[model samples]
Structures are given as structure tokens and as C-alpha cells.
Target: MRADAKKNYGRILEVARTVIAEHGSDASMRDIARRADVGLATLLRHFPTREAMFEALLCTNLDALTQKAVALESSNPPDVALRSWIREWVEFARSYRGVVTMMAAAHTNPASALYASCAAVHSTSARLLSNAQAEGTARPDMNGDDLFALMTALGWAVDQPSFAPRADHLVHLITSTVLLGRVG
Candidate 1:
């Protein structure tokens, strides 16, 4: 790609991220282009289709999230690492309801790049969660993916008015229910 093309691509991705993060994954490419300060023709020249664009954006974000979960394993104790992973994931989740929805969609679309990302997230999270459990840091009852599922559910729920007040309570519930006093 030429320098201008590269810039356009970056700009498209940035605008897509912002739009998707703000409006949900169903945000329009025209809106993205307007937000990117680029023309619709330019956006189409780069992305071609909305699925293509959404997949690219989702893949990038999911990769980062999985990497963060894996990275947390290298931190201090198992429980501490798990908490850090959840916090990081929540940060990613809180950015948009679309993020979690995209990820869940990816998990179901086995042939999609999003599916591959979901696989990686599942594997890494399971491994890290196992480490916490083996170390007796996590609640012995719940496994790794369960912990992440809770995070995703709570994170997703926080976007709704009815669930807003329960955000902190949800976090604490997952913590206490899953950690059982294993915060160390």
C-alpha cells in the first residue's frame, strides 16, 4: 500500500473503532468515513464490505485482549494475575457493548477470523484460570472460562440501565463467588 493508502487504512480502522465503540458494531461505514474525515469511496476502496471491516477490527481487538490475559499469567500470584486479567478484559469490554457481542459472535463462527481469536482467548483464559485454581487462588468450584464468562456477562450487562447499578455488585459477586477470599 502507498503511504496515503496506509494512512487511509489506519484512519478507517480508527474511525471504525470509535464508531463501533460508540454506536455498536452495526455502525455504518458512511458514518465511519465521515468520522475518519475521509470519503465513502475511500472507505470502500479499503474495506470493500462491512463484514470485512468488522472482522478486521474485531480480530485486532480480540488479539490484544487475549495477549493481555496471557501476559497476566506472568504477573505475581495466580489470583492476582486472574484479577488483573479480568480488569483488563473489563476495560476492553466497557469500551463497547459491541466488543463483547463481536467476541461472542466470533466464538460461534468457526470459520471466521473472529472464531480463531475466540479460540485463543478461550485457551489462554483457561490455562491462566487453571493456574489460579491449582494454586488454590481461585474458587475451587469455578474454572477459568467460567470466570471469564462472568466478566463478559457482567460487562455486557453494565451497558443497560437496569444493570448499571449492579456493575460494582456484579464484580464483587464474581470476585467473592469465584475467589472465595483468595484475592492474594
Candidate 2:
């Protein structure tokens, strides 16, 4: 990419992140363009679709989540690492307003741009779950698919304005259900 084009692309993504955080995944592309001080055509040229924009926005968070999960596995006890990674996953899902629905949809759609990120998240969760299960800290029956579904539920819980305050409790309860021992 040319320097100016690359700069514009980065600016649009940065603005979109802020707008999406304030508004939602449904945040308007026009508004993002306005915020970024770029033409709508330029934004469209770079992103092409809402899904593509979402995929770009999610790349940073997903990378961080993957890195954090790996770090936790090395640094913490099996159960603790699993729980910590779960909490981080929930936070990642909650960071973008209305992202849970998008993630859920993209998670199953192999053609979606967000699919790779979803797969990476699922893989990370699976590794953590497997480690915990091997250590007898988590239930053996729960797999990566199950953990992904539960994480989506956690995202949904935190997405609601009313339920947001209780998200931590919800996480603890759900973790208890998957882990061998209660979390809270």
C-alpha cells in the first residue's frame, strides 16, 4: 500500500473503533468516515463491507486474547489460567458493543472475514480447557465448541445495559458449571 493510502486506512479503522465502542457494531460507515475526516468512498474502498470492517477491528483484540491465553498457560496454574483466559475472552467480546452477535454469526460462517479470528479464539479456549481438564480442574466433557458458545453467552450478558453490572457474577457462575469446582 502507498503511504497516504495506508495512513487513510489506519485512520478509518481507528475512527471506526471509537465509533463502534460508543455506538455499536451497527455504527454507521458514513459517521466513521466523518470522524476520520475521510471520504465515504475512501472508507468503502478500504473496508468494502461492514463485515470486513468488523474483521479488521477485531484483529487487534483477538491477537491480544491469543497472546494473553498463551501467557496465562505458562504463568498460572491450570484452573487459574483457564479462568483467567475465560475472563479475558469475555472482556474482548464486551469491548465492542453488539459484537457478540456478529461474532456468533461469523463463527459459523466459514466465508466470513471474521471466521479466522473466531477460529483463533476457539482454538485458544480449547487449549486452555484441555489443559485444565487434563489437570482435573475442569470438566472433561466440555470442548472448544462448548466454551465458544458459553463465551458468546457471556458477551451477550455483558452487552445488556441492565445485566452489565452482573457480568462478573455471570462469568463466575458459568465458569463454575464448566470447571470441576465453583468459581466464586
Candidate 3:
């Protein structure tokens, strides 16, 4: 890209992070363009779609989480690693409002820009869950898909005003259930 275009792209991304943080996944592209002082056409030329913009916005963090999962897997016990990763995943999913819905959709849509990142997360989650189950720390009946669903569900819950106050408790409850194989 040309220097000016690269600068515009960076600016757009910077503004997008703030807008998304404020308005969430449904944040308007026009608003981002306005905030970045770029024309709508320029923003569209750079991103083309909301998914493409979000892919750029979230790719770095997703990669970090994937790497974190690997590190946790090696440095911690299987149960600890799985629990830690799940908590991180929930936090990521909740970073932008309405993101959990996008994530759930992206998980099943290979054509989506987020598919690769979500798939990497799911793969890592499966490995972590498998390790825990093998060590009798997690339930044998659970799978990576189940864990992914739980993460999204918890993320969705915590995103709501009613559940936001109990975020920590909810995370602990879910992690305990995953680790102990029982609700109580």
C-alpha cells in the first residue's frame, strides 16, 4: 500500500477499536470513517466489509490467545490450563458488545473472515479438554464444541447488564463445572 493509504488504514483501525469498544460489533462503518476523518469510500476501499474490518481488528488478539493457550498447556496442569484458557476466551468474546453472536456464526462459517481464528481457538480448546479428560480432571462426555458453546454462552451472559455484575462468579462456576464434572 502507498504511505498515505497505509496511514489511513492504521487510523481507521485505531478509530474502529474505540468505536467497537463503545458501540460493539454492530458499530457503524460510517461512524468509524467519520471518526477517522476518512471518506466512507476510503474506509470501504480499505475494509470492504464489516467482517474484514473486524478480522483486522481482532486477528492480533486472537493470535495472542492461541499462543497463550499453548503456553498455559505446557506450563500448567491440564485442568488449570483448560480453565485459564476458557476464562480468557470468554473475556475475548465479551470485549466487543454483540461479538459473541458474530463469533458463534463465524465458528461455523468457513467463508467468514473470523473462521481461521475461531477454528484455531476451537482446536486448542479441544486439545486442552482432551488433556483434562485424559487426566480425569474434566468430564469424558464433553468435547471441544461443547466447551466453545459454553464459552460463547457465558460471554453472552456477561455482556448483558443483568449478568455483568456476576461475571467473575459465573466464570468460576463454569470453570468449576468443567473441572469437577458437576455443577455443585
- TM-score ranking, best first: 2, 3, 1
Model 1, 45-94: lDDT tens digits are: 88887767876776777788877766777766777777777667666677
Candidate 1: where are CA atoms >4 Å away? Answer: none
Whole-model lDDT values for every prediction: 0.74, 0.90, 0.90
Error of 1 at 167 (Å): 2.9
TM-score for predicted model 3 compared with the true structure = 0.95
C-alpha TM-score for every candidate: 0.83, 0.96, 0.95
RMSD in Å for all candidates: 2.5, 1.1, 1.8
lDDT of 1: 0.74
Pick out the ten consecutive residues of candidate 3 with the lowest summed lDDT.
175-184
lDDT of 1 at 86: 67
Residue 65: error of model 1 in Å? 3.0
For model 1, where is the 10-residue window of minimal lDDT? Answer: 175-184
Residue by residue across 60-82, what tens digits does model 2's lDDT show?
A: 88898899999999999889998
What is the C-alpha local distance difference test score of candidate 2?
A: 0.90
Better of 1 and 3 by TM-score: 3
Q: Is candidate 1 or 2 superior in lDDT?
A: 2
